[model samples]
Target: MERSHVPVLPAEIVEFLKPDTTNAGPVVDCTLGEGGHSALLLEHAPDSRLIGVDADATMIERARYFLGPRASQVEFVCAWYDDFWLSYTGARPHRVLFDLGISTFHLAGSGRGFTFREDEPLDMRLSDSVMSAAELLSGISQEDLADIIYVFGEERYSRRIAAAIVRARSSGSLRTTGDLVETVASAVPAAYRRGRISPATRTFQALRIAVNAELERLRMALPRALAALSPDRGRMAVITFHSLEDRLVKWAFRAAAGDEAAVGRSAVTAKHSTASKFAPKLIDTVAMPEGERITVLTRRPVVPSHEEVAGNPASRSAKLRVVEKTRIEESW
Candidate 1:
């Protein structure tokens, strides 16, 4: 099958970003998977430049090809967002977009086991620098593995699944995605296995998150992204697929926006909330600012429209949150 990616929330992104028409600054795409979103953004605002960043080298090449000569206006960087943010010395971005969902290329062709339907190797690393999911599972302790699954995947049967994996590893049977999927299926209850969603979904998601250190990377990149935004004129949008990611974006933006009402309503302290039970450790990973620097454009995350969901089932879980940098006061 041909690999293709449908940029989620296209109309909303263009509508909200309203990319600077005068080429005032670049619109940075932190997760330039297939470059669908960036291409659309450029097309909408022809004068806008793009700074597209992706960790996968294949994605970089593909995005370059996809962008054609328009790629000249885009700076395609092959590095993880956090690293790219650290070394970046570019014009302040008027718009920044981060679509955290995995790309269709990885799901369909890269064969890194993003999809459980395929019996590929259990290597979910987004880049070659990190340890593959297979290596991670085979090396970690059962307790730690269970914690990772429970925290990142929010899988209720994480303990059972971890125990099964340990046993399978001892027998040298847990090497491929098929093995992991079977192990998870055997660990969960019959009802859970028969549920609408695959029993392996959570486990696969957890493995992918751990292998990519996704949460950690996001935590590191958010602050830098905020700093890069052009005050008063900058807009940033983030699309998260999972609860852990959504919560991080929600609170981080809330704190930055200084939305006292939202912060007051948080179950735990905005600075440090371990209330999730699932990803308790992640609360500390993201440092929420105590003061205002931006405006939360969306009170709640924007979900995919019914029409969009019907067209692309994979986009059903997408939640988009936007924020705009607050105007700076000149120090006379």
Candidate 2:
């Protein structure tokens, strides 16, 4: 909780999305990590109703404290964003934001082994009900694990990393974040170990994605989010951290904006591979949502300025994409 999460593009988000100024809004923050983004959004449109959702209870509590008196305007929901949206039957949202991917809270504070630098339990479940990373590594096949690391993490050394994990499992050494890091370190080449990015980074990311079902949930949640928007003026902004997430968001937005079908790579398939060796049919075949379309507000993704990134290096890879809902017949 001591490590505060800086919302990636604070000014850009507020400037792009037009939240209801009539005090009759219910702007939903789908991934309310540390409440930084929601706090600023509420401050910008003080009268708007706020519904903050986060899978981690720790994050929820911290966000609640951070929001302080603004808590009165918020309806805090401790649930996955997709799960929350699936059953939600409240007033349509005036504006919605999805700050996708893990935040600093996960790496530094969540004791969930989201960080390879940490020596915590390999329990990377964003929600409580799912299997932890430790459990996943224990039971999964090396080939399937390699595929996940390749397709999800885009790691070139996926086969090596997965094989190392399998070997570590036999010795019961894949129990914690540090153990996994050591295993990854031992598997990859020495040069790769000393690369700019840590060797374990992609493996950890892939494991978290698998354990939390992040991409699957994102696909399910996008159309629902678009549907939840107020048709007249509802806008949704998504900030993705990596290539995989950005690709998914781009395809979904294109579909909503009336691309014939935003068909793209199956979540499990690698571009070089014919098909996924493991996992179900995870192809994205998105289309217009319920006879409605959207106007993609961002022609190109907005990136953090050099000044911002210099101040906060973690913000360097962030990309913000925004969309506004419109009737099918309406032309921008």
Best by lDDT: 2
Which whole-number lDDT from 0 to 100 does residue 193 have in model 2?
92
- The segments of candidate 1 whose C-alpha lies over 4 angstroms from its true place after superposition are 1-3, 259-292, 329-332
Candidate 1 residues 1-332, lDDT tens each? 23388889889988887687754878999999888889888888877788999999989888988888778889888899999989888887889999995797888888888889899998888899999888887789988888778778878898999999999999999888988889999999999999999999998888898889888788778877877787746899999998878887887677566555444333223433244443433322222333326878898899999999999988999999998875656567
Please report the TM-score between candidate 1 and the true structure: 0.90
Summed over model 2, clashes come to 0
What C-alpha lDDT, on a 0 to 100 scale, does residue 311 get in candidate 1?
A: 98
Candidate with best TM-score: 2
In candidate 2, the residue pairs with backbone N, CA or C atoms under 3 Å apart (3 or more residues apart, or in different chains) clash, namely none
Question: Model 2 Cα displacement at 45 (Å)?
Answer: 1.1
Global Cα lDDT for candidate 1? 0.82
